[model samples]
Target: MSFSSVSPSPTNHHQMTEDEMTSENSLLADRLHAMLHQEFTSYPACPDYTSQADHSSTCSPHSRRAVVNDDWRRKICEWAFGVVDHFEYSREAVSLTMNYLDRYASYAQSKGMPLSRKSFQLAAVASLYLAIKLEGRNEQGQRLTISTLVELSRGLFSVELIEQMEREILTALRWKINPPTAAQFIYHLIKLFPVEGIYDVDAKRVCNGILETSRFFSELSVYQSSLAIEQRPSIIAYSCILNAMELVGPVTLPCDVRQAFLTRIAGITQLREDMMEVYNTRTSLRELHSAITDAECGLPGGSSSDANQGTYDTSMLASTRVSPVCVSGRQ
Candidate 1:
């Protein structure tokens, strides 16, 4: 079930001229921004249930028995990351999976139905399964099958049960499965802000590095419920880029230019405080970058050595968890 062997090599697009590349990047950025705006207006919140009584039992009559705290939620997401990494699913898949879990949990809570601890992992797995189908594919360009997913889960679930859970999740979510994820926003943002004055070759390399590193941080953000649920995906993506820029230590923009860029990002996301909170507290950019390098360079025994390697050992990532002080502050 390991996806390591089937991982696709990076595609080269060197045939495109600089102007054409910029045009393509700009078009993509516009599309992503438009999609985010559309989602914001159409699904201001997770789709609502048809009836109040339709709320999950764990969030209703058994509400008192369904008290899962943020720490517990973080642990569940961490475990999901382990599952995602072990199977080599895309980071987008994992982030989108957590988005479903969080939004559904939030919607249920709003309806006075909080999920019980016992059912949380089921929801996580179902969300993961759905996200893989939505955002991941095998070398043969086919989505992972239920049997493969079941085996990946170490036989903890059967095909029938997982299918049932998936249906329940979709029902509970009111079929609003496609939401803007941090990774999506980050991809667009990187295109919008290219490295200045570099040749096409070097610019592409630097841009890809920033995108990959920002994506790692964005994936890590999924485990921090306070940040993930509270901030818009664009805000999270913007913060990640800023952190990535810091780590990459590229040429600094002029003060006024930097201020203008921040202003533009703030206006787009409209969650400046949340963005700053994410930057200052929710993630340690330096430590995360180090962990990614360690995982890539095989600092951890038998880890993958490919520079473009996306999957990493969950153990290496566990050390890069958000600071306890940040978690306490959120509480």
Candidate 2:
């Protein structure tokens, strides 16, 4: 009975007969409409409705139905930024992709391209995949794959046979995403401990190994076409990398995984030395940027937007895109 909850039913047509997938799709569309109904309905005629709590006073009859779909999309994104999102990075990345898509929607319109909210989501998921790949990791089969994403998008559109719509959306978004380099993630991570100077020893140590292992794993990647990339890794790769660092220098390690770490990290001779540089550079940059920004702190929206803008930008998000996916309840 709570909004956004569509109880699972066996005939989930996204898995069965997709054309018959109307009920669930309608529920999602309706949920979206409910969330952003005000924004959609109050356009043009209802200018002052935005200033009022009960927006119904100014919405036109014709505008109400059509805009409901758009409002529904806006609501979905709001929900995504709320509960259920796992990583701040993921949320930010997806949000940016959505905003770009919204802007591109205008472009698509100008170019006579048909783009629906569902098509846009596919592009966003594809962007997520490419971002992960550029960030130097990958997922298989069940995640972010083109076919799966297209199927996942089934419920976000209308029942009007949108086959060409999906194709057009894919055409508009020629698979591209901006990957934050390791240094970018590292710089941001270091800020969580914000005081700057020397990072915690273990944190510094693991970062070094992450870079080394990143290269090591990059080489190993050639053979991975045969590996099930989506297979849940034994431990999150970063956690595994941290444990690997315990193998280096004064740190102790289990003989086996330890030996593997040393072997893998050996690909880069300057491993420890690089850690020192990363630590120094991050520490110094943090101080420099902090000093510069602190003076600009109270300049209206400047500091606030500055705080929110990191590797990912989330300024124009219009909806939450829940994966029709139910991964293991693991965080």
lDDT of 2 at 25: 47
lDDT top scorer: 1
lDDT of 2 by residue, 119-170 (tens): 5444444434333333332222223333433344454423232334434444
Residue range 119-176, candidate 1, lDDT tens digits? 5666777888898888667434667677866665566677888889889889877898
Name the weakest run of 10 consecutive residues (lDDT summed) in model 1.
Answer: 321-330
What lDDT would each prediction earn against the true structure? 0.60, 0.33
Best by TM-score: 1
Off by over 4 Å in 1: 1-26, 43-66, 139-142, 151-156, 199-201, 250-331
Q: What clash pairs does model 1 have? A: 59-113, 59-114
